[model samples]
Target: MTSGVIRRVLLSVGVIGTGQWLLSDVVHVPGGGLGVAAVAGLWWLSRSPKQPRFREPASLKGWIERCELVLNQFEELEVVLELQGLRSPREKELRRIEGFDVPLSVGVVATEGSGVPATVQLQQALAGAASLDLCLANPLPVTSTSWSWPDDLQELDVLLHVLPLPLRAADLLWLDQLPADRPVWLLLRSSVDRSAEDHLEALRCQLPERWHQCLLPWSGEAIELRGVLQPVRQQLMRAERVREGTRQRLLNNLHRRWQADLETLRRERFRLLLQRSQWIVAGVVIASPVPSVDLLAVAVGNGLMVKEMATIWSCPWSSEVLQVVARQLGSAALAQGVVELSGQALLGLAKLDGASWIAAGAMQGLSAAYLTRVVGVSMADWMALNAGVAEPDLEELKRQAPLLVARAAEQERLNLAGFAQQAHEWIQERNSCTPA
Candidate 1:
């Protein structure tokens, strides 16, 4: 109910009650009706329904789709396939070429001079491939032979045939001289009566950048193919390297920016959450398990991150050489100060003392996650505090030392069992500490 309506109702009840009360109490007229009416009015005012307001939730699906679409626009995989004469062998070749695994549009341009045999094959091969405008340049006019092409592929043409004749051998000198609208791959007799290198060089000199050469023998055999696509391959390699470097650089930059932005957002989220939550201790069951410093920062920045804690704790250290190390950690050697036990001692400490110290610290809340702001912790302090652990020498355990073997075997079993038991105890302990 609105405050306005409530106020008016309360006012009416007050006036009516006052008039009645005046007649009864002041004028001595009897009846307890005025008080009852006032109570009823107030109750009615309190029982009205409130209007609801609605809001839309924040969703990023639309934005994500738009971003993906934009990224896909940069994909470059277009390649054009060029076929000159589609004959018997050419038909088979065309089928194979079209069948090749390439996600590109193939544009075939047949010469008008190609015999009817080649022309029929070309038309058939064009059945399932992309057909750019076809140009025919024959001496005599032919019947309407191109009528049966698919509607989408009926764009045929009649152009001058400027090769293999009056267009002298030297006339074909410039492959670059071809029209820019076309992507060319000359299908010539592999073993021409003349030199292959000279022929290729002549065509290479004349063709425009649009021309890409692929030599095929008259027999259409794959084994006999020449021109290993070397030039095109080289160009593609250079372009690929340049593109890869650019893409890698862009990815790195984007990742770095994302990390920076996320870090700031996380900090904000943490602050907001803290304001809305309470952190009461269930007594000092364990001194603020939260360390006064961040463990990850200390480990990484100080170069003391645990390297072999899992192995020493979980795997046998005797036949494993690591069990012996676990024994040394809680042993007198650890208490005697920085006692450096090269083999067994190091391994034992890594498993037992190192794990216990770190685990105890973690449970106490002396973890990196809580101490993100502390910057004074150093590598030495981290190592001294058991934040750093080393690998166990499995190979050495199998060596000729009897004392090592005996101790390793005992330590290995204890380390594994201790690790499991400790894990369970920590969980129970932490749960008990959290306030209900």
Candidate 2:
């Protein structure tokens, strides 16, 4: 237990020390006194001999009950089977009453002059699969442009293109003309001497970026083909469930709730990391001697924090969007005089007698740090409310910004004091090390 505490302390000190070095040396922050001081204080606290409290584990009965509850909620949806070849006339009669819900109609297009025996074997294997409704289109000659699909082909949910090992130019052109909206799967015949790498490279060079994702190599074996087609089968099953009127609405609600729960868990886990990052940024900002550039530093640091929070919430906003949000939040803080109030509070807490410029710098740094924390918290709340649903309302966020800033100021006051103590300790350590 003693060794574990020592190890953790050492790790913490190392990380903070490295960050300090990077800020001073790489970023070339003028004076770097505040950052160095912050690092030293953090190091001393980390080295302290206090034993951390251990969290208690949940009871076994409670765990078992939770598991049972989850199991009860699990509903098994219908599975769609992938049938390969042409449906036999007799099976067509049986399919009408099989009670399988809207099985995806799959059309297999085998290019002419390709491996006929291998294609035939693949088709046969697919037809034999339990629940799939497969339609094997008539083989088209390499140059034929007038070939028409079967009248029933319009109902196909997916198209599987089976091509020879090295795709011909004509084959590529034909593939380009296929409907873009529907899912398409490309299967290439396996070569005896050539590796999968060679086959992938050949396709990558000729195919568009969109088509690259759909390419798969086929060895003409039933078991292998079944494994490769699993994703397509899953998609078909999902589509069938969506088409079922009442069940579709229930499924959609359940899916949304499940996603929301996942997002909540992720946000909880990331909140700790985000708080730690904000503390570090606060310390760094407080150390900056230049008042003019302090806000810029704060914006950059908080912009990164917003980006990370967006990723945690699975929000698809771009980096530019996040940066804009951070900037707007910062501007709001400035306009509302939140920064000035925070600076005044920090100055009162520090009670440091120094050059007017040094005091001014300290105030600016503390204010920037305070505003950054407020922005981070407000953005996180906004993202949580809109996760996987809709765009965040900037006006709503702006309206709530002042209240968030006030709350953050109260919370950050305690945090800033703790940070100042650490920074003071770091400064003392540096003084002792200096040759007197």
Candidate 3:
């Protein structure tokens, strides 16, 4: 509250107390004091800050219902799963065709003598996973488990896990094609006659290098192996590009959808800031010419500030525009016969006066025609006279430094005569206002 209001409140309280004492017969000093204390205590209590209360999370049923609703919107999806287990060489080969059959479905079953049952453990461990995969756990006390096609469990892809058997023989007998691409990982039990090293060495000589095979130890319930599906770098690059495109599209859609909603616009703006502020502005600051100039100044300042934040030493700006300006400075230094000074030094010199190097650089890169369209001048008149050029037309190069640079480059190339005319007009206008 304002001090005036506080003073008025105090004065009002005093007036009321005095009025009660003078006009009322029952007004006692102790009662009046007690009343005033009570009022003060109430006011203090009312002015205390309040804490916000949190609401409980939505129910599981509600979440599930929402997920179901979303899923209903989609018409098609594909789900695939692969399982690996420990078994005999012959058994593995026999089941290989079945495991690698059409649509590539497999549920690997571990043999009892294969120890620990790696496949079963993996199934039990990942039971609560949010995936479409369903692992059928095979327990110990080995018995011949046949692949059954049950009507109720038609979706389940079954495989009797075993070791290496002849691929041609298995294919001939099963009359099925194997998934040549996917790999089969082996779980080595301690009970095996040969060490895993021996098996791997023998297999390495027979199999192609492209076929990925890893040996994992079966220790009780755990089957451990370190492996990776070799990454496709080209595919990853494409995927990143796709992801960036998707992010941009999503942002564009959201901005369009909520441009008028204040809360949404605020959130979008904040998100854009987080994303390096490359969002498309709906002409928020540049509605008027004066404000447009001011907005440009602020943008330039922010760019410089961002550059300053990146450098260890105090430098003016490191943005692309400033680098252009730095190049110009270097060129100017070179023209002045100071060839010993580096480009970096020239850039530093430009920044020393608190002038925006980026803006200067922007000026450097512009062509005469573009400068005419934007700032109406060339930089040829601003720079020292060039050899074999007509006294550097001062009338045609009357714009600001950056614009002059652009126009000068354009004039050198002679891209547009109309722009030269416009520059002449601007120069004449300036000359007309000058004192004799």
Candidate 4:
């Protein structure tokens, strides 16, 4: 008990130290003067919290159904982009999993020499499967080796290559074409008990080392056939798991591609929506003298933008959720002094003096717009991370504020010139619309 306790304590310490190093030193992504706590929080939030499985998994049909629904959502997102003269054909990739099979079948291929004798050996071998651990149906056909079969040869789960003594050149050519992903067992047979293994091992260097284990010596008798077929049975038993894993992988890959494409289109829509929301907030700032209701107006405008963003992601949202994201980003932006930095940036762009009121409205408009962009971008990232998860905890947004705000700031800084031009035009248009 004492040794086990000490070992566990040491393991816990090592794990903590490794996680600390990974957060503090390995991942420097949030490094634009952001605090170490922010980086640590970001790394923590990014990991999936599911425990590892040690046993065989149940059927994944339910998960596959959810993916199908997501594919339908992808089609809807595609229609949104198509309205603006852009076409995305990737949603159609979901057709790959339409008729996927969950079970695997087996096939056999035999060499030229000892044709009838090889058939007898294989027949007895498959007959012995009754005593094996796995229940396998023996599709017994004493088939001759061929390069390819007429019917769907891919249906075969395990291909057993039967070898008779005295290796032939044609046998090597036949072995070369067998599928690499599927296992091919080399069933070795001898007519007499005095036969040597060297004659059968002529192609040893050319074959994989793992295939060498499948070499079994038999004079083709019924009693010993069961053990010969055990290894082949084991490989076939894993076919269902392999097929399930493959289907899931195909669906997941398509989902990722759809996500990337969808995010690209949604980013453009986010900027457009932020432009409209910030202009409304700017008008509110100018309309109110005392500024008590200005915050409410900004909140309302941002709430609508969040709702629209949720619609874009095919998710539902609430006002409370909106407040959580907006409040966190607003405070972090101010804490990082990005609001002042943005104001100073516009003052330099307009080439106006600090005391000049000429660009004040434009500055106000752009500042509000900048914060909205950061919040919208941050919300998009959070939604993407929490998609398909029902009722994700809102507190994660609170904990993830600094990293989300910093990352969005970095992203928005890339197109500052274009945004400045849009902000200037927005202010001028609003000024013209006002009564003289």
Highest-scoring model, TM-score: 4
lDDT of each: 0.30, 0.54, 0.30, 0.54
Write the residue-wise lDDT of candidate 2 on 229-303 in tens digits. 665565556655422322322232333454455454555656665555554454455444333423543443453
lDDT of 1: 0.30
Candidate 1: tens digits of C-alpha lDDT, residues 1-436: 6885565455444435443543364334476443344344334333443322222112233323322332222111011112222123423432332233322222333333432224444344333323222333233222243322222211112112223322233334333234332223444433346565556565556554344334322333333332332332333334333333333332333323333332333334333332111010111112322222221122221111112222211211222122222222212222222112222333443444454434443333222221211111111112222211123332332232333333433443354444334434543555464457
Per-candidate clashes, comma-separated: 32, 7, 12, 0
After superposition, candidate 2 runs with Cα above 4 Å error: 1-248, 259-264, 279-289, 351-364, 395-400, 403-436
Error of 4 at 387 (Å): 2.8
Sort by TM-score, best first. 4, 2, 3, 1
256-367 per-residue lDDT for model 3 (tens digits): 2222222222233232232221110111111112211222212322232223322211122223323333223323322332212222233444443333324332212112
**Lowest-scoring 10 consecutive residues by lDDT in candidate 2?**
72-81
Q: Which stretches of model 3 miss by more than 4 angstroms?
A: 1-106, 110-120, 124-129, 137-177, 181-184, 190-193, 208-210, 214-436
As a TM-score, model 4 comes out at: 0.52
Give all TM-scores, in the order shown: 0.18, 0.38, 0.20, 0.52
Which residue ranges in model 1 land beyond 4 Å of their true spot?
A: 1-117, 123-178, 190-198, 213-436
Task: For residue 94, give model 2's deviation from the true position in Å.
Answer: 30
**Lowest-scoring 10 consecutive residues by lDDT in candidate 3?**
279-288
Deviation from native of the Cα of residue 72 in model 3, angstroms: 28
